[model samples]
Target: MPDRNSAAHRAMAAAVARMPDPVSYQETALLETDLVAAFGTCRAVAVSSGTAAITTALAACGIGEGHEVLLPAVTVVMTVAAVAACGARPVFVDSAADGRGMDLNDLAAKTGPATRAVVAVHLAGRTDGIHDLAAYTRATGLRLIEDACQAQGTTSGGRQAGTIGDMGCFSLKDGKLLACGEGGYLLTDNTDLAARAAAYRTHWQSDAPDAPAGTHLGVNFRLAEPLAALARHHLTRFPEALAQRREQAAALHRAVDGTPGLEPITAAAGEEPNGYAALWRLTLPDPRAFAARLAQAGVPNSTGTHRLTAAHLHPACSRFASGDLPHARVTVDALLAVPFTEHDTDEAIHRRALTIRREAVRWTR
Candidate 1:
């Protein structure tokens, strides 16, 4: 068991070998359609990365300089950059105490006259009253953008994670269910939105080369044919990969039961994840201290995909977060992720992982 290869490492090697040469346009469409099909009633536009997907979606939605968007502080900086990249302002919202989803109470409090959209982050595959969050936008007349970069196959009430919003953005970075080392996609049911997004992917080239009006403020964010090919090869096997991940999450959840310093919240009722990122929202007395202990305890990994950059680290433009995001800060301080699914990860490695986490919980107290 000790000499066995990491399941993730092996899958990476195989996927690398499968990367297609001279990425194909036809294959690109196939991958895009498949992404949309999984989500139902939506069109998927595959892009270079989830960050690109979000930026393209935001831009196509007509958001621009001076526009404001509602987002959670508990996530990575890519979408924040996407929003900023499109010349919009990102208003950070604090997540709920449970650390599973956005804090709607905070979101309602933050909605303002200049708000253009509310971006619901399905953080760690945890949906925090996203339905209610979306409804709030419906009543307020603001657009809804779903950030599912970490949520590949998440479902809420028979609806896929990305399908439940006006537009959905996903990531296929090194660590995701739909991963091909690095890739991302945008999905939407709105035909016009899909058309706009598609145009943005290829440097805004309209079918007519001479038309100056073809691409409006677009960027070359297209996903490579080879990566899309990688996506095709793995998407076929995703169902099984997700199942394996879910099964492992169940085991880790059981093993950590009754641990106080570390609390692992389960999927909200009727919500199922594709097993991409298994989140542990921290409630430790001293999160930083606990994290250090956890690291020393041999916790194999960690993540900061959806979190705020230190004010000093952020671009001067981001220094002034358009909205308040206290809970966002809290979630960032406590979030933890573990490798959930890989082709042939040793079953024992899974147990060892659980044991390490349980020990960290003991140290938390």
Candidate 2:
């Protein structure tokens, strides 16, 4: 999306102008260093993509072949692909009733001897019940991985999303809160795990002859210098950007506060959401039809659609047959995601809220 005169274009061009035979790792990668400071994590390991970050994190945690990693059924396919990439089986866990987090009971039921870790996805920047999930993982002795791809700037109980679990993965893909065109990074406080992930990111080499050999199998998942530079520039504007998004989302939530047949999805106790996306849980019947009505009223919604389908339903995960994810199925059917961003003006936010309220009331009657 960058044009010749755009700042991103210039930053990338400047980065390209400094290119040597190849981009050096870590030494000149200011982005990863900045991420560690920004996210308050002890270490950050940049990777080619968010999925690569997950795979690296899994490898760092020793989750490999014959291991079972539990993850929400309502997640992007790339999440499961990360597990499969490690030759580990992805055990699908049902979603919570609120549709913002995983169902604890379902997670308990699905966890078994093969379950070595749990991937708690903070869907849409909402981290409801993450504290409880973290406690559960600690009690059960399972490694916790927070797939905070959708929650880059979000937090729960005063802790950053990625820092709460054993390992946190973030996506810098376009459209994300902290995008870099295409990149990702893993964060963790565990010294050993951090070193393991750093090495895994680049064929497990220490960039020196006497450096440790690849402790875990890995690929060339290094974050390109241009992308890292772009990420660093974006970070400079993130605080202001986050504040603007929260303000707009708050205005919209207030407008629909008491609208019948519509309830705004909220953050859990002690959690500060990033307001990356606006979600509403329908209290009326026929959610798919309601979403259609909303679109007709000039407010398009991603509801009862394929965008948030159950991951088990995907062909790539065919090994895990469907029909057991009751909570996920129900939540997907009733929830709707309205388009939102920091760019929306106050007037636009109010108008979208009004459109939602008007259609919700009309459908209820």
Tens digits of per-residue lDDT for model 1, 91-140? 87777776656778887887887789988776666666778877888899
- Candidate 2 minimal-lDDT segment of 10 residues: 207-216
Model 1 alpha-carbon drift over 4 Å, by segment: 1-24, 207-215, 279-284, 301-318, 322-325, 343-358, 361-365
RMSD for each of the candidates: 12.1, 9.4
Candidate 2, which segments miss by more than 4 Å at Cα? 1-28, 97-100, 207-211, 214-216, 292-300, 304-306
Q: How far is candidate 2 from the true structure (C-alpha RMSD, Å)?
A: 9.4
In candidate 2, what are the lDDT values of residues 201-312, reduced to their tens digit? 7665543122344323557888888788888899999998788777766777888878887777777788888877787788788887777677777775665333556787
TM-score of 2: 0.85
Best by the lDDT measure: 2
lDDT of 2: 0.79
Report the Cα lDDT for residue 182, model 1. 88
